[model samples]
Target: MKLVIIDYGAGNIKSIQFAFNRLGYEAILSKNPEEIKTADKVIFPGVGEASSAMKMLKESGLDTLIPTLKQPVLGICLGMQLMCLHTEEGDTKGLGIFQTKVKRFSQNVKVPQMGWNVIKELKSDLFKGIKENEYMYLVHSYYAEHCDETIAATDYEINYASALQHENFYGTQFHPEKSGNEGAKILQNFLTL
Candidate 1:
């Protein structure tokens, strides 16, 4: 199957490509809209500032292209945050695929909760083989807030939507590609979709 990963000048494309390669899938990293639109599966992965990421996406036109996609689309980290309607990070605007906003975690807890964290309240196909309260890799300061589309929840300083699903659109705050075996399964499930 053809997997097109959006390379809007900011995504951590190599890790995602490595993940799919380990699964025996030849995933292509491309910024071309045609490739993205026609792919069997699409991954929107990123690791960077929201505003700068959005700026790059807008320049490439993927910001407008992604939300309208009919096939399965997965966003990781900043890509997931960009799928939301807005973000307090840099006061940025997002693709609005999910009606949620990204915000900074409460100051009481550590910023950028980097490392493995448990994700529970699983309720979608994305978590098909994943167990409840299973640990996943995370590294972020901003998070998507509670929303109807939220399928998996995680708790750090506060409970928030760690993963979201709405129709063919899917997103994860944690790095499934970096989360090991269970994380690999999640990516496999996404590919199967």
Candidate 2:
């Protein structure tokens, strides 16, 4: 199957590509909408600030194109945050695929909750074979609020949506590419979808 990673100038793209490489699947990177539209699977990734990332998506018309994709699409990190209805970071509007909001963690917790965190209450085929409370790599300050779309939840200062799914769209606030074995399984599940 043709796999495409949207390279809209914002993401830990090389690492994601390498992750797929290790899975024995070649992932193509492109900013062209037509190429992305034709792919069997698409990955929307981001690693930088929110508003700026949204701007880049808008510039490429991906902001509009992403939500309409019929094939399975996975959004990672800021890409997942951007898939929500809105984000506290930069007061930016998102792709609105997840039907939730992204809020900043209070000062009571570490700013960027870095390192491995357990994700529980797993739902969706994306987590198939993945046990509950499995650890996944995470690094972020903003988080998606719990909502009907939330397929997996995690705790830092409080419980928050770690993974979301809506029809063909799937998103993970954690970086599966960086999360090791189980993470690879999640990506592999997405590939099967």
Candidate 3:
């Protein structure tokens, strides 16, 4: 399969590429529109500030291209946050693939809820072989709020959408590449889709 990982000067691209490699697929990282559009599957992985990321996507014309993707597209971490309607991180507007907004974690709890957290209320093929309450590695201060697109939910300081799906688009607030076996299974499910 022609798997393309959208590269827009974000962190964690290598780890995602390596994770796919471990699954026996050679995934390419590219910012070219044609390369991204023609891929059998696309992975949008990001780890950085939302405003800068959105700026990069807009500059590269990817902000317009990503929403029109026909094939399955997976957005990880900041990539997922960018798929929503808007984000509180930088008062940035998102692609709006999922009709939701990303908000900052409450101040009552430590910001950037990091480490393994259980994801439950699974509702999509993304969790086909994975059981409910499976732990996924997360590292972010902003999160997608619960919405109709939320397929999986998690709790930190408050209940939030851990994963979301809308049509062919899928997103994960956690870093599946760093989530180990369960994470690998989730990626495998996405690849099969």
Candidate 4:
């Protein structure tokens, strides 16, 4: 199957490419609008500042094209944050694929919530075979607030939506490609979807 990984100068991209490669799927990294339009599956992965990332996407015209994709699309980490309606970070506006908003984790808990975290109350095709409360790798300072689109929840100092799904669009606050075996399964499930 053809999987397109939208490249807009974000980090951790090669790792994701490697993850897909191990699964016998070589994800194409491109910024061409036409290539993205025809891909079977799309992965919008990013790690960086919100405004800058959005700027890159907009400059490449992906900022507009992404939200219009008809196939199953997944956004990881900052990619997920960008899909929200808005974000507190950099006072940036998002693609509005999900109605919720992204906000910085409360100071009560350490920022960047880096490392392994367990996610429970799983829902949607993204978690089809993954067990509940499964440990997944995460490295983010911002999170999506509670909303109807939340498919999985995680707790740091407070419970927050860790994964979200709406129609053809899906998002994960955690990096499934780096989340180990269960994470791989999630990516595989996304491919099948």
C-alpha lDDT of candidate 3 relative to the true structure: 0.95
lDDT scores for all predictions? 0.93, 0.95, 0.95, 0.92
lDDT of 1 at 190: 95
Residue-level lDDT tens digits of model 3 in 99-149: 999999888989879899999999999999899999999999998999999
lDDT comparing candidate 1 with the true structure: 0.93
Query: Candidate 4's error at 173, in angstroms?
Result: 0.5
Model 2 compared with the native: what TM-score? 0.99
Deviation from native of the Cα of residue 79 in model 4, angstroms: 0.2
Query: Model 4 residue 141 lDDT?
Result: 92
Instruction: For candidate 2, list the clashing residue pairs, or say none.
Output: none
**lDDT per residue (tens digit) for residues 75-113 in model 4:** 999999999999999999999999999999888889989
User: Candidate 4: where is the Cα deviation over 4 Å?
Assistant: none
Looking at candidate 1, what is the lDDT of residue 193?
81
- Candidate 4 collision pairs: none
How do the residues 102-184 of candidate 2 rate in per-residue lDDT, one tens digit apiece?
A: 99999999889999999999999999999999999999999999999999999999899999999999999998999999999
Q: Spell out the clash pairs found in candidate 3.
A: none
> When superposed on Cα atoms, how far off is each prediction in RMSD?
0.7, 0.6, 0.6, 0.7
C-alpha positional error of residue 40 in candidate 2 after TM-score superposition, expressed in Å: 0.5
lDDT of 2 at 79: 94
Give the winner by TM-score: 1 or 2: 2
